[model samples]
Target: MTGISKLLMTLGVIIFVVGFLMQFISLGKLPGDILVKKGNTTFYFPIVTSILISIILSAIFYFIGRFR
Candidate 1:
């Protein structure tokens, strides 16, 4: 059981890393509006923002698992 758990964790980490790599190569930004007013920026669709966040979270998980 312990070995199985470790294998599953390793597989999860691999998937997360591959996903993170894919997110970095996306073309163009998310499908949303880029608004700049009063020197402030806001996104409407937020696709790019979401992708970045996902990548960060996945990387964090991957490293945490490896270190553990």
Candidate 2:
């Protein structure tokens, strides 16, 4: 398969794994994440979770690139 196809497949599998884990883990609700509530209004942002995922993915891709 081509590079784009390989990337998409990797992304799909990552998403699937994350979704499956969400059933047992509370990822987005961690401390340092943002959640706003007002009269009849609500907002949410998983800042910490995003940072954690970015770090993990960065490490993963860094190793992959080093090997390749």
Candidate 3:
């Protein structure tokens, strides 16, 4: 397989694993996440979750790059 195909497959597997874990994990409700409610309206944002995911992915890529 080509480089692009390998990258795509890796991404697909990562997405599948994340989706499966999300079914059993309450990541969206993590602390530092924002939740605003007004009368009949509500808004939510997972800032902490995003940052944590970013850091985790960064480390993963860093290690992968080092190995490569």
Best by TM-score: 3
Distance from true location, Cα of 27 in model 3, Å = 1.1
**Cα lDDT tens digits for candidate 3, 1-68:** 59778778777987898789889988778989999999999999989999999997998678666755
Candidate 1: stretches off by over 4 Å:
1-43
Candidate 2: regions farther than 4 A off:
1-23
27 Cα displacement, candidate 2 (Å): 1.0
lDDT of 2 by residue, 30-51 (tens): 8999999999999999999999
The Cα error of candidate 2 at residue 21, in Å, is 4.3
The global C-alpha lDDT for each of the candidates, from Candidate 1 onward, is: 0.70, 0.84, 0.85
Could you tell which candidate, 1 or 3, scores higher by lDDT? 3
Model 3: worst 10 consecutive residues (lDDT sum): 59-68
lDDT of 1 by residue, 1-68 (tens): 89779878887987787679888776445556354445466544656767877897788778867876
RMSD of each: 8.3, 2.8, 2.1
User: Candidate 2, overall lDDT?
Assistant: 0.84
